[model samples]
Target: MAQVHLLANRKGGVGKSLISLNMGAVCADTAGARPDGRPSVAVASADPQGTSLWRAARLADQPFDVLDISGDVANVALLKSLPYDHIWVDTPGWAEITPEEYAAGKDPLGDEKYGTLLSALLDQADDVVVPILTEPDSFEPTWQTIEWVLKPRNVPFVVVINNWPPAEGIAYVEGTRAFCEGHGWPVARTVIRRYRVHTNATKVVTQYHNNRVELQAREDFFRFALEHGMRTAAAKEVVS
Candidate 1:
């Protein structure tokens, strides 16, 4: 069965699509071809926006396949049985936060259509990656995603701090880390730093011209991938 990695956050505008594309590419490229000739990795977009699918379409060649499972009940049903070693899902932003919803203790995924598709895909998620910015405003939603959704359902996840700048975001980086620590949440040791190369990236980092900047960008993901892999392996070992 393919290990489905869900890149999700209650709030949008994070690096979910970018991570879904490049991280899958890195793992696919590194793992090389499967013996059965199937693609080693794929990215499935559950986001209504189709950011990952649209970006993959623009690429002349993709290391991994991209699937548009948005609003597709059939596709989501057979997601786990797909012939890939790994699958990354870019989930849509959740429904708007309303006082009534909170008071009622209801956590909605989105509108009816979106909620249905998201619920189906999320059911098969083997792993979840929650990305957040350094700003304090992103914290409450992150907490809601963790507390109301993931924790209640017993979903395995990691909170990764995305788009950090070496000089500009140093303090905020620490603040974010501290926040995660206070909550006793698991945060990746790797910090995905901000660069024009990432926010404006059109192609996979490996597909870039292979310059120093691109190499650095790829390394950041590689490090995180390594850490993520180890954590996943450890979890499996414990389960076994």
Candidate 2:
């Protein structure tokens, strides 16, 4: 059976789609592991932003398909029917934050749709990966979303630190770690450093194209996935 991975976080601007595309490539491009000659990977854009669709059109040569998922039950059912090795979903950030914004509440997930969507999404996902920014502003929503997902669902997830600029200093990074540890969230050991190349490449619909710095970041992410018992090259090695 194919594994389903959802790139989800209620926090916007957390680099969710970019990570979805790159990680999908990592699965599709596993060296020497395509002998089964199957369509091994795909990305689903559950957001209205269509980030994955634009990226797919730009690359044109990516090995997997890009799908769109509205809230429609039919589309969701079709996705569940597909035979794929890795189905990755990029969900809208803070699908539940609209109500919070309206209420002037500090809780970001105050909207009800967020809860509905999150419940449906988690029901289909084997694992959820939450990408978080290290600053104070991004931290609360990260925890809020985590708490929401874990209740009565037991959805397994990991928190990844994104946009981590070295110049931001270790103090902020350490603080983020302390917060996660205090709450018992799994923080990926590999921190994806902020890089100019990541920003530049995203401008042109570049999929799976990385410079040295971004490539290093990709490796770090892969290591985290490996350590967490998620699929990686090591799993492919068995098939190879």
Candidate number with greatest lDDT:
1
**Top TM-score prediction, candidate number:** 1
TM-score of each: 0.94, 0.78
Residue-level lDDT of model 2, residues 1-240, one tens digit each, is 557788877778898887787667666665223457655678888877777777767774666777777455345645556778788888887545444463674444333554455557778877788888888888877876787555446776788887789887988889998899899888877777776655554432224346665566666546654564544444456558
Candidate-wise lDDT, in order: 0.84, 0.69
**lDDT for position 200 in model 2:** 50
* TM-score of decoy 1: 0.94
- For candidate 2, the lDDT comes to 0.69
TM-score of 2: 0.78
Give candidate 1's whole-model lDDT: 0.84
Worst 10 residues of 2 by lDDT: 200-209
Question: Residue 72: error of model 1 in Å?
Answer: 0.9
Question: In every candidate, how many clashes are there?
Answer: 0, 1
Assess the local accuracy of residue 221 in candidate 1 as a C-alpha lDDT between 0 and 100.
Answer: 89
